[model samples]
Target: MSKPISMSRRKWAAAWAVLCAAGLALTAALDASSARDQQPEKSVSAECDKYIADIETQLAKAKQEGTEDGVVALAGVHAGPENDDCSDAFRDRFGGDE
Candidate 1:
């Protein structure tokens, strides 16, 4: 049979349990706070989607034309006012000049 745990050992075990519980609580609180602090993700707009499609078309045409300069220019196209609302989306999809 296993010997009964000593009083000092019981105290130490209790202290360790409390410390672990406190650490878990602290981690949970930090995770919750960080989630609240983060900005919400933006959804891509229809205008931006259309803008991207146009860019893709241009890129395809540039490839067909076999003009390296035209292809490069289209590759680095920036988002304009027509689709400014989804500038971030454009940047993510095609990378922006900025």
Candidate 2:
């Protein structure tokens, strides 16, 4: 006659399969989240570009004719480590209000 299988062994095998499936699911979720987080911040940069452009155009016009409007534009121009003033001015002149 054949011997019967042990209950403890069967339970352990089931538990192990469940744990592995859970681990795989967790890994996939984390990878998806990381990918989402890596997307470039394009909108914020685009808005800032518009502001910078306005300032630059004003500066250029001021250079050409020394007008008060140019001076005001210069005041509104964003100047710092993160923006290009000249490009910003060009964008502003082309209608980048935000």
Quantify all predictions' global Cα lDDT against the true fold: 0.73, 0.65
* Candidate 2, lDDT over the whole model: 0.65
Candidate 2: residue 4 lDDT (0-100): 96
Clash totals, every prediction: 0, 4
- Which is the leading candidate under lDDT? 1
Weakest ten-residue segment in model 1 by summed lDDT: 68-77
Clashing pairs in 1: none
Model 1, span 21-57: residue lDDT tens:
9999999999999999998877667756776788777
Candidate 2 lDDT by residue in tens digits, 56-84 = 66667777885635335244545675656
- On the 0 to 100 scale, the lDDT of residue 73 in model 1 is 36
